[model samples]
Target: MFSRIDRYRWSFQDSHLPEVTLFAGENVAFDQRAVRELRQMLEVQGTMNRWSSHAPEAFPEGAGLQKVVLTPDFHKAKGIPVGTVVQTRGFLLPQAVGNDVGCGMRLHTTSLTAEQVLGHQKALIPKLRRMFFEAGRNIPMNRLQREALLREGLLGLMDTTPRSLQEGLWQLFHDQDLTHEAEHTESLGSRRARNTLGLEDFLGQRDFTRDGQIGSLGGGNHFVEIQRVKNILHPGIAHAWGLRKDQVVVMVHSGSVSVGYTCASMIREHLSRLYPAGLVHPRNQLYPVPNAEVHEETVLQNWDALNAGCNFATANRLMLALMVRAVFQDLEMPTDFPLLYDATHNMIWEEDGTYIHRKGATPARGFEAMQNTPFRFTGEPVLVPGSMGTSSFVLAGLGLREALSSASHGAGRVLSRGQAMQGSTQDLDDLLRQHRVVTPVDFARTRPDVAREKLKELLQEAPDAYKNIQAIMETLQGAQIAQPVAELEPLITVKG
Candidate 1:
């Protein structure tokens, strides 16, 4: 059973596992199955004695679970819940980060106004589809550039790609712009990668290659939406972030698709190989790699794989933003899309000495953790995207230690995929029209069969599938976890 510990937090405790605190409102329902799975996963900690542990001098604290916290948008995922945060010492849980490593949100404040972008909506929608869905995106990268990006993230791209190569869509890779943009991004929006699994083709040739994943938004709730500032909750902070009333902003929600999946597969396979010969596998198929002398090498390799996928995901989001910029340029809008911030919701972060694994949860670091970045005074820009056709928000992290300095990634799903699919197609279409959202699927020219298939797919992510964004925001504020800087209303949404 769960009890309301406070206005912002609900507490659940099992005798066999650590207590889980969820930051949510009174209206949100708690998933008991997720809590049970979490307890079961934690119970495996007792079985660590089965594996031989050489006293790793490197990790003095050894390996053990430390804390578990759930964000306001917490929901049941496969084995772990989305919007969950787990902190551990001297160990790394591969399943904690899951397969979608580096999946996150990116926001860019544009020079154009709502009036300017909306006025051209009729003419701009097709252009956006052509650039995003069609083969109109021209991003050229040689093997060196590709390897650099996969190995070292955006910094690697800037260091290796020359001025001459930065043409067409590549022009957005200006050194100055990248440098400035990095200053605002979380952890500088990059991580050094040592392994490039399943990326041989893109890394074999010396000349430019046309890779499909770089600029593509992968499936399942990933989107690029154009929004206008709906309200200023914190004028001082909003102004600092260059947000104003009715100003247009572009938000991209995506992740490392094939690259992340491949990397995850390789890492999990290695874990399986390391498993002791006569032991039964964990029922949930989740494995945790302890920081021991015997497992140190494997841990390093796992980190390398994780970092590679993360770098690829970061680069992927960057390319998506540039694609949007290219579309605007094609329509004669000024190419002044300054990046507000880029932050990952799914990844592991090493803080001080503990490892914090966040799945569908964003880092809401306060001033101290962000002292060196442009957000030093305002704290990290926590981008919480709402559901399709709902109001999203930009919040400033307050760095609450009790909450492990984290916030929700988006409005959590209210209905399961199966339940959402059962809704009427007409209601889905009506929601899309009511919000003025544009999708790549052109129903006007497509055959009835094709349109039905597409509509079926889109119905799963309808706005009604998510919780109330206003309630979520209220919890965040009431909890003192993060303060809202501004609210964004969708102008046009581009779903993949």
Candidate 2:
């Protein structure tokens, strides 16, 4: 369905459909149906035609899909490919952004070396399991703090002083690190929560209490991994980014947990209600909310919900990093885990009057776009993690406008979770043992029933479930979308 335009690019051109550009190698395959569904989102029958003459004003001039680009990890997902990047004028497609509003990658450079972390593995693994899986996530936030997080994310939390819990986990925050954290975080890791829908329980309280979802490493591919810098692909950028050979760093892959899904569901329901009566629904079931006067309230509410959900997600990652710090503290190791960069791959960005929706795609802006941040000299740090038992890469965004300044989020899933579960469990065990990956469960100590369930989860996320990350990196570099700075090998991995 696509013609190879170059070694790393493919173009699907149709006179009646919007042109799509896919960035991948021959080894990567695309779901034909996903490409068709993507085309449907841009055509007359797909979206604009669904609006009734009952509301002609809703159909504005020059309002439709504008551009589409897929990263190397392009694969089938609900409605669109996982690595799809689409830009639209005068409208927003929440489905393109997906349920995980601010789900993204966060990287931290630590002072310890791989030898230091690995040396403590014997005593460290159980503590990690206890803290991450058991009742050890003790992050307590008052209603005000939660409200600030919802309102302005990390910036809001930094501005507000916690009146309770000045010791222990709360000590992770310091005035000196506050501004530095914001400076390194993508977009300051804040979004204005204009509307707080379905979040009543998380707001309006003066007392500090712990919530289950805030500091959690949610299921699926989400994880907290301690990695060692395995190789330095670009020594100049690696040194500039404070990455050294064999240095230990923490990589967190997570999102807003239930908070993000709740907001996404609300937006979807709102769109469903606004859809014109007696019209055929979009074939892919993907809906778009127009940015028009008639739909002003709906649009505003959506933006607010998106911002709030994203705020929660950013806070969730920060809390998770602190939890990791707590582990280091108990081990009497250095707990200063300075954030290298925190960025969201799944979100919407308004650029030059166009909404760029990225699902499992990272914002890879060049030095010019990042002039205000510390990374202005080197460009944005793109954190692309691999599947379990693989090496992750730290790349610098080249910010090529041709690709909408985007890159892949991970070595995109090759197999569905169901398909991955069908893989051999013994293979997963061997890989875990070989790679020295530490999961939350101790299969030998756990009950057979519980072990089986945990093993299922493990098998679903096995490294074999994903494409070759080395190939993905090659495609990325060959396409000139991003340049690899350093490669990291996982030393200890904590999965929920």
Candidate 3:
């Protein structure tokens, strides 16, 4: 099954760099651009294989890279492929995780049905706007509460923060027992992240506006969507996960926002100075902090900062979900919002003693690997969301060793944002009307030219900019990496 074909051949032969592996299903053509990028990565050092492989000269020397794996959604990113998974033995690559340190997806199953939300659409939007916008005044958090949440994650927030400050958020935190929700969240929404580097001092020197960002959804593909479970592919697992057909679920796709970017920039700057002079490539903005070269203290500092960022991201998603709950409360609807799972696709994890960097890829540990959690019988839930106005999936991991137990985070971008903006001739109103996706943008109030440009920006994120999600999901299932459990169709999408 793994026989080499002309299409799978590497562009250049190198003895030192490991051979690039392609995992597309039979009859499926791999992305040529990604293949070329991988080939360029092999030629860059001739010693260490780069992850992105786009601009070989940009990568620094002696990266200590061990392996590079591309998912079915592989596509060209700034320097690396969006669906690329990079493994390193004794080094940490900043760019591998990208600027969004803990950018990820979170889903909460609600007692409210699709009918309730769709019926209340007229009243729901105003309340949602009040909770999401208006300075995030609905969900208030003090400096101390913000620090605790950042330092400790969801568990920390529950244990330390005052319950009186934000009753809605507090109620949401205790909606289900911490242990139950923690089992669903990656790293339990916080791994008791210790800050030894005084991130507080650094954050203070910067803009340092944690309260405002907590419940706010960041832009560029980030959204809080109301979706309906259209179909249950695996009935048993769906039942076990408390999901049913026609049930409403709130899905939040966001990240650490400015907090994460700030931490990543700081870490990148520190690591950049340590790069060997000639090793620094102008095109390669990524730098790896190898354990061998850097002092133990510096390594610890970087790790601490990264952990802090990850914790902040986890809390940020939780806060965003809580904000959604607040909207539900304001509308006096079914208030039970039990968390299904929270997982990060853009981050690094220490698995089996090797650091695996997953950029736009979800960790799909199978049943055996999740013995301690409720998913012991079923694998961890792998959420693969689609572009706006499309179907999203909930999958169970198969833990394919060849694919590093990872799946694509979303439908990989086929066209760049700029390209989509330039080429898009989509009729925004008609498209939305066709899909019945309610957005906050009031097209009627805006000027015609400005509205057209805004519509282009919206079209840039339309389904056309992405690869066929059905194809991507099929590729994952064909490769035995994950199997779809449930399919969700978006009813209402809230974007920044």
Highest lDDT, which number? 2
In every candidate, how many clashes are there?
0, 0, 2
Better of 1 and 2 by lDDT: 2
At residue 364, what lDDT does model 3 achieve?
91
Clashes of 3: 2
Whole-model lDDT, candidate 1?
A: 0.82
For all predicted structures, in order, the TM-scores are 0.96, 0.96, 0.88
lDDT per residue as tens, model 2, 212-289 = 678878888899998999999999989888899999999999998888998888888888897887777766677778
Model 1 CA deviation exceeding 4 Å by range: 49-62
Please report, in order, the local distance difference test score of every candidate based on alpha carbons: 0.82, 0.83, 0.73
Residue lDDT tens for model 1, 1-496 = 5778877787776665565688888876566656666666665565454443432342435567778899988887877888899988777887788889899999999889999988988888888888888787888778888888888888887889888876667776662388877776677767887757566855767878777678888888899999999999999999999999889999999999988888888888888987666666777677678776767788888888888888888888888888888888788897478899999998999987889999999999998889888988998899998888888999999999888999999988878888888888888777777776666677777888887777778888987888888888888888888999999999988887
- Error (Å) of candidate 2 at residue 482 is 0.6
RMSD of 3: 4.7
Per-residue lDDT value at 340 in model 1:
93
Candidate 2 Cα lDDT to native: 0.83
lDDT of 1 at 80: 84
